[model samples]
Each structure stands twice: as C-alpha cells, then as structure tokens.
Target: MKQVLSGAITMLAGHPVAPSTVYRLLAKAGWRKIVPRPSHPKRSGWSRRLKSSPRR
Candidate 1:
C-alpha cells in the first residue's frame, strides 16, 4: 500500500492511491488472493510430495 501511495504521490500529489490501497479495494470487491503456481510443479519432486501429503 505504501509503495503504491508513494508512487501515486510521486506522480501526483494531494490524493493518491497507493499500491496497498489498490489491493484493499480489490479485496472489498471480492477479488481472490493471488497465489503463484509452484514452478514447474508437474516436473518437480515437490509435486509428488504434495500429492502424498495428508490433508490438514
């Protein structure tokens, strides 16, 4: 948030939307949290571990 706000502030003073604010607004709008996929999960051994791991 601070980063975004800072960027906005740098670009235009007065009221500025910070990066954090954008995330907050998205959350309010029911946006899901983004999770990056594990890198090459299909080709990694970690994928097998994930499949074998018991659910919590």
Candidate 2:
C-alpha cells in the first residue's frame, strides 16, 4: 500500500488489476485509507535520490 501511494506510479500501474476494481475492493474490505497519497507540498524539482533504480 505504501509503495502504491508513494507517487512513483498509480495503483493501476503497479497492480495487475484495474484502479477502480482495487478501489472498490478496498472500500468493501474497509480499507478506506489505503488510497494514493496526494502530491507533495514542499518538494520542488526532481531529486536524483528519489528516483527508483533498476533492480538487479
């Protein structure tokens, strides 16, 4: 859940299931707070350290 909400990508992009389907599942499972996080407030400019590196 944290990975999905980390701003790297949308839930649908990370998960094989559709975004709406995941959302509905979460809702039905009482996982309301498991949604994506909004854009960061203070972070400005792309930081090299924030980028995800290719896994070996």
Which candidate has the highest lDDT of all? 1
Q: Give the C-alpha miss distance for residue 48 in model 2, angstroms.
A: 40
Per-residue CA lDDT of model 1 for 1-56, tens digit only, reads 44754676557755766566667766787877669886665677877789889999
Question: C-alpha displacement of 53 in model 2, angstroms?
Answer: 48
lDDT of 2 at 1: 74
Q: What is the C-alpha local distance difference test score of candidate 1?
A: 0.68
Evaluated at residue 46, the lDDT of candidate 2 is 67
TM-score for candidate 1, residues paired by index: 0.33
> lDDT tens string, model 2, 1-56?
73364333354467455556656756777875646556666665565345655556
Sliding window of 10 residues with minimal summed lDDT for model 1:
1-10
The CA lDDT of each predicted structure is: 0.68, 0.56
Candidate 1: residue pairs that collide: 1-20, 4-18, 4-19, 5-18
